[model samples]
Target: MKTGKRIKGLMACLLVTTLMIPNVAYGSQPPYSDKAIQRVMGKIYEPTTVDLTGMKVVDQAGAPLNAELKFMLFDTTIQEYSPEVHANNGVLDTTTLIKGHHYILSLADANYEMKNKYFTLDATGELPKDDKTNKNSDSPERESFDSITVTKREQTLTEEELKKVNRIPFCDDNNGAGKFVSELSGTVDMPDMADMYINDYDVKFKLVNQYETVELTVDEFGFLQGDMIEDLNYAVVMETTDPELQNYVLLQDLVTSKNHQEQGENVLTRTYTHYTCNPIGGIYLADSSYEEGQSMIEDCTYAPLPSYSKKSTLDGIRVFIDRGRKINTDMPGALFKVFRDEFVFNERVLEETDEKLVMDFDTINMHRDEICKLPHGDYTITTTLPTENEVQAVYNVDRAGNKVEDCTFTQEGSNLSIETTSVSLYNTVIEFKHVHEFEKIDGTEPTCTTTGVNEHWKCTSCGKLFADEQGENEISLEDTVRPLAPHKYEDGKCVVCGASDPSITDPENPDPENPDPENPDPENPGEGGTSTPGSGNISTPGSGNASTPGAGNVSASKKGATAVPATGDNNPFALWTILAFASIAGIGSVVVTKKRKSN
Candidate 1:
């Protein structure tokens, strides 16, 4: 009887030790270890529970609730949720989790009653209801509870349950009207929603001014088409009433058509967004991976239902491509590339409606009429060809084909700007002008007779000269000439070029060399004269009296005179008389010519 009691006592001690094993194992480590937090923040955790594992929650009726679950440690001392332990989306890993620690599993659900649910894990690593006896309550109405006996269930939703959840993928909308039509046909579009099941439902149009409901069938292209009543100023609400779309959040449900009669038909578009809410109970800290004192789940999922009652003031744009006189036959065809503007916020592009403008050739053909619907923003148009085929000017035209004077566009080489602000089909005429490819023409060096041109530029294809490098300032061929230089003559012959002066009668016999006027010969008093043509001195024929060369010249008529023997007689007197007569005759001829006139 004593051995049996001893064995029973040993078995009871082992059971006690087993119950305390959890605390002893977790005691050495800090509460809410950093490694567990890193797993919760795997790169970046989305608000949805799709990435979470190990637990599945259900409602009171045993239906699986698509709720976001968050596991947090309870501080026994404070009697509240603590930062010591945290696991996102009910991710319970037995190897990593602490033993014997009281943990609270909170739920974030759309249903308000189910949102306040909390579960606890006891000393044996089993989840059980928090009974009110432990300062907690099984009744969800009571805010706080501790001990309660409840059923523990863990199973994922069946395929049928997932289908019933009904989450419609968010669709992107250009938020602008469609193509221009001849008549005012009302159109409704759900952009990028062709493949989704919700797109097959009919759109309901409720006229507010009149008690009428019209159902428009969705076309094969996944859009609604109908015509608004002519000239009836009744307000219309285009919406979806299908019960399957109850969970989807409508982002935008209406588009205001401006000048529908003037610019033809417009399209009314819709936007729907889907998201799963995240739990919002955690002590946010500065050192945590998320924001300080804030929850990423709450911030991301919080949004009010979108409402659209205001009038849409959208504008339409029409492009007229004028391939102006392309005179050069050798040049290839010119192409203009269009670019829609993008609006960015916080390093993210918020709006970029269309990027396929350049991809579709028929849409932006050279001369075909193209009318496009665009949001109110700036746009750029540029040439795809080389600089030789650049845009000359861009004119904003009216419906009457006349240029609009109110708005002006700027052109920087090949680029042109356009801004849509009004309902006018603001005709944008892109007139392409041929640019000149001017090459530098080296100038020719001028000579004495021929004229040469200065440095200038000439068009490679067309023979046109321009003074400036940009080819703006045009110049004539004569304007670029370096004038002919005159012949520099010295002693009846040109010094620069060896050409004789035409005015000289006989260049070889040039005349008696003239002496320097500033210097006088010492032998001849106060006289500056050159030497005779053949000799330095003139020897008188009759007398030995040497007439020193003075300011007098022997005439060319006396070139062949023979030297007579010195007679020392009347020959010297007669020689002076003959020279005096010759000088007088020569002076008379020059005077007569000076007074003469052309007949």
Candidate 2:
């Protein structure tokens, strides 16, 4: 047991000796011998000369470069010692660096961008990657000091120099495979006619794939900048929010460059060009039939046509008329009608609604001299001349007597568009001289066979007809035709004008040539008279009257007239005389027989 204890004491002494001697990999000299390590370990030391040699700037392709640049150091371990340091001949001084702590070396310049490199000055420093170590490391016995160059690339710059430039953070916590943040920038340019500043309107922007919108404030030159998530697949959409500005001013997207990350760019920039349009209008009138009225316009003086102001809106416009040195109602038969001009599809009007007339002439005539409110749109105004006057040529002239090229006139009237200005009109009238020379047309009575005419008057010079003799009311010639009247007949003839009727016949005085067979005459049996005469024999009136032959003959005549229906005959009086004569003969025969009986 004492031998084992002696062996253990020997091993313990050997272990103490091995610990006192420094390993060959750490360094042969004591760590406190270096002033930088002494300062890190809290030991007092004087500063030593820094070693900064044999290092140089290079491009991505490993080519040596000549450029004006700057340098900065960042501490990655316990918060300590971050400073803006300078590089002498492309190498940094290592004497002030802390031992065993990680650092980031940043090389900054306007002409080139250097990526961050992790480095340390002391031999005991730990590296992030096992194989890729910085060139600044120094150790005599470590045998594994393989040096790999950091990648470099050339980059263009803005107008600012290194002092004012914002460089990327070294060993930055906010950068990784999935982390991306960047600035969006653009310039807005407007036409000179807009007369507006970029700050006068509110601008909003949104990403194509994003639903939220962000506000961007532009400076005097319309330069804007904002922070946004970097995206290669998304595009930016920008617009002005003022509702009134949208009417006359519009935004034109000239350049929208997406995929800024793919292009190795930091900020996405766009160019916006704005355009503007104001309202205008014009008018035309022509009345060559009245030369005197035309001369009146050439002699008058009035204000120039009104142009649209910047303050004008879509609903704020006026199209008016002025009668210089004349009464408002001087032109009685003239008509001015205003219809919403819908013929053109300013953008696409015809495809929407097909309606035109807004204010007719009758409504417009009531307010001839008052202010009329008109919207800023396409319009058609029809000016109808009086009956005595005719339109020959229409000219759209300004107050200075110069022709207005913007407005045109047609025979029907004028079509005006109020896009950039306002318009006005003037009119006058003159009566024509004429007289009516009437020719009287007498009326004729209507007959059964012919049409008649009503009394009317016709103008000889104008060929106009009138129902009255004064010729005040005009009528057509066809209105004077009268229809035929019904025929009135008496004795088989028209009583009105003595016209014969073939359908009617007189039975008492029948025509001898074309006698009716149904009417047989008594005097002549073949003719159509009352009946056949004296055909039947008569019986004796009494036993005594039968002795006389003359009395029997008279009685036979009476029986013949009675048998032929004398009451219905046209000569019934002749039949009655025969009956009376027969009666007288019978009485005389009876009286003579009485006298013979008495003797």
- Highest-scoring model, TM-score: 1
> Which window of 10 residues has the lowest lDDT sum in candidate 2?
273-282
lDDT of 1: 0.32
Predicted candidate 1 versus true structure: per-residue lDDT over 298-370, tens digit per residue: 2212121111111111112211111111111122221111111110000111222211111110011011011
Judged by lDDT against the true structure, how good is candidate 2? Answer: 0.34
Model 2 residue 350 CA deviation in Å: 33
Give the count of colliding residue pairs in each prediction: 11, 12
- Model 2 residue runs over 4 Å out of place are 1-438, 448-450, 459-464, 469-478, 485-498, 501-504, 508-599
Candidate 1's C-alpha runs over 4 A off are 1-392, 397-407, 410-416, 420-427, 431-435, 461-464, 467-478, 488-599
| Cα-based TM-score, every candidate | 0.21, 0.19
Which consecutive 10 residues in model 1 have the weakest lDDT in total? 181-190
Best by lDDT: 2
Error of 2 at 230 (Å): 46
